[model samples]
Target: MMMTERGMVAPVAGGSVLAQFDDVLAAAAPELVGHVQAVKFDADTGRLGVVPDASAYGTKLRWCARKLVTAANAKVQGANVRTLHVLAPAAGKAGPATAAAALDRQPAAPAGPVRTRETVSDGYCRALAAHREAMPPRLADPAIVQAVERQNRALRELSRQAFPKPDAVEDTPARLQRRRQAAATEAAALRRARAEKAGRQVAASQRLEQTA
Candidate 1:
């Protein structure tokens, strides 16, 4: 054990108020560095929290993350908690909104044996629902409609890639490599989430966990 800033022998590492938000997402939504960010504690509570990008998909991601946090808190030493926050408006909110609505209308292409209809539909729904709220009135121009549609299509394609055909293993080596890279990137994000969450768990009020 080591002495905490308060002169107490804290049991865990990186448990500071600053640490709680160290991994907080730089932006409110997951538009860039995309995907849901989560925190989990391995040492004590396995306490969990999340920071997801703002959009329809973001909401879905938050829901799924809470479920995991709930399960972990129940089984682990530390209880899980989450904070719902909103970020200031972004410059391109209109773009995301238009694209999402257009994508929601079309079905994504199938990835042969690896992809599932259910997964594709879910992705399409998520893409369509993104940025549904708070779109600027000025973006209603016809020019933006086409551009937004294209962006939405691109987003749908990315979602389609989430599920490979069951036989995607037989696909080209380069394609497989790309997919592998995507998986690795996703793993790094999960690690970041856990680190941030553990920090928050340690700093909660005394009545929360009653740490020594």
Candidate 2:
């Protein structure tokens, strides 16, 4: 990984993360132009491939890749900055580290999931579904993730929490294989919707062309 560029500072400091595609490819060739163009990760199918053809998007791709490299490095630097200002605990010297250790030595109380008990917010239920292992087999299943996410966004606004980002975990080889199989199941429904939309647009355009 590249070090932080000159004059860049991170907001939160250090965290492990990845950009969607470019970083995976351009790691080998830092001088490579354009983004890791046309990348796909097929979990079930166990596929990780990229087109790497950034002729049209060359400038934008390189700009984004450089930005991603800079951001990751800045995070590491931020943590080092915080440690420099740690003040020693006073003349009698009751140190914060000693107090922290005392707190850690106490027996930790057991924690459990918050009980909604029939008063579940729509957002929480939807989050559970979106993160489900095997989604329900019903017509309601298809729109549940969307409904939950939309509701979750509204709830986040009300509660002052940030909305969740898109999935960041890269699938393991096994999970990728399962997701590939699952993806196959959804592909037909996806195709049907696209064909229906395309047909409607084509019909409307043909009518205009005929009248012209």
List TM-score per model, in order.
0.20, 0.16
Question: What is candidate 1's local distance difference test score?
Answer: 0.47
Runs in model 1 with CA error above 4 Å? 1-34, 39-49, 74-76, 79-212
Candidate 1 structure quality by residue, lDDT tens digits, 12-72: 3314311333223322222423343333222333333333345654556455454443433
Give the winner by lDDT: 1
Local distance difference test scores for all models: 0.47, 0.45
How many clashing residue pairs appear in each of the predictions shown?
Answer: 16, 5
lDDT of 2 by residue, 1-212 (tens): 12333324321232212222334335434454243332222222322222323343344444454453443335333323211111112222223344334334434654876566777888988898887857755566658889999999998787654544458546699998998989997998899999999999999999999999
